[model samples]
Target: MTAKPLIGITTYLTRARWGAWDLKAALLPASYPAQVQRAGGLAVMLPPDEPGAAEAVVSRLDGLVLGGGEDLDPALYGQAPHARAGAPVPERDRWETALLSAALERGVPVLGICRGMQVMNVQAGGTLCQHVPDLVGHDGHNPAPGTFTDHAVEPVPGTLTGKLLPDAFGVATHHHQSVDRLGEGLVASAYAEDGTVEALERPGGGFVLGVQWHPEAREDLRLTEALVRAAVEGPF
Candidate 1:
């Protein structure tokens, strides 16, 4: 029997104070691993590290999933922090950037979610809003982070995402920051009525899709299935 495809998920660093030492440990939510397993892939949590570490992780993985969390460091996009930049986690930002770059170059199927969406964009020479609420003058995106809210988005007439979710409109959202400037070679496949890019994809590349939503957090399994299919089928 063929072995299951190995899917690597980028992990976050957590500071746990124990004894006299502040433990810097790798952490990720359980949903990601559970999602991968449900989709028939063996999930591996890849911790953020140096650039070299990113290459090492990519080499052993059949596919990559960029999980959601935190905000990207402003320095990555040649900008100063906005008033709402929050606490910058440079290490996680750096590692995720390297992972995205390496995965694209290696043609590994990649599925990015929420903050993962922003990481892919920044890695590809794009920029973000940093804090959408300040710029947009509203906070509709994150009405309540954990609650399921529906937002209307129009998908591009012809694209991978369009093919997956083809209709007049679609729903799902929970983000404060979003793509402000698109990355080179990426096409905005979907957009919210407020003009935030909700989904993105590379025209003729492998399964390189990013969604500004937590599909794993939802009860639907189709999103996870699509990613696993792409990985196992060796990216279209």
Candidate 2:
């Protein structure tokens, strides 16, 4: 019998509050695991460990999802932090970056959401617009503090993103940073109305894709399904 693909999702290492206690925790949003499970994949959380431990950790997974979290250190992409950028999570940056490289080397399907997408770009020699509002002149991408902003994204036809999403659609978004330069061998697969790069895909086409939105926060399961499918069927 075929077992469900084991999907590893990266988590945030930060102080979280629950059960009358506030403490540092390795946690991911419930929606991430729920989304993976709903897509017929086994969900596992990958917390920030020693950066050197990533290869070993990734070797055990069928797929990898770089879950969204804090802003990456500007040093990662050779830039200084924007005045508006939040503090960096250096541990997460190092761990996730290593995990991404290891997963890519091993051909594990990857789905990068929000900050995850930004990480992928940085790891691939790309740059970021530290302050998105500086580019778009508005905070529409991240309209509220905790609430999601709704906007339309147009996926380019013939790309994996386009294949899964197929056309323009409204998506839930909450981000203040964006890809400023295309990564090596990566293509911008989708875009927002203001020309913001909303999605990216690796050229070799082995399920290495990233989107600048929270797929878990929405009802659509196509991205997760595609990751699981790739893990099950071996790259398309």
The TM-scores, one per candidate, come to 0.91, 0.98
Q: State in Å the error of residue 190, model 1.
A: 1.0
Note the residue pairs that clash in candidate 2.
none
Local accuracy of candidate 2 as per-residue lDDT tens digits, 1-236: 89999999999998889999999999988999999999999999999999999999999999999999889999888888889889999999999999999999999999999999999999999999998999999899997898898999999999989999997999999999999998899999999999999999997759999999998999999999999999999988
Error of 2 at 155 (Å): 0.4
Quote the lDDT for 98 in model 1: 89
Give the runs in model 1 whose Cα sits over 4 Å from its true position: 16-23, 145-148, 168-172
> Residue by residue across 1-236, what tens digits does model 1's lDDT show?
87889999988888766578888778887988998999899999988788778887898889899998888888889999888776788888888888988898899999999999999898889999987887678778888866757777787787888887787454657777899999999989888888788989887888999989777876667667888888878765
Worst 10 residues of 1 by lDDT: 165-174
List candidate 2 segments past 4 Å from native: none
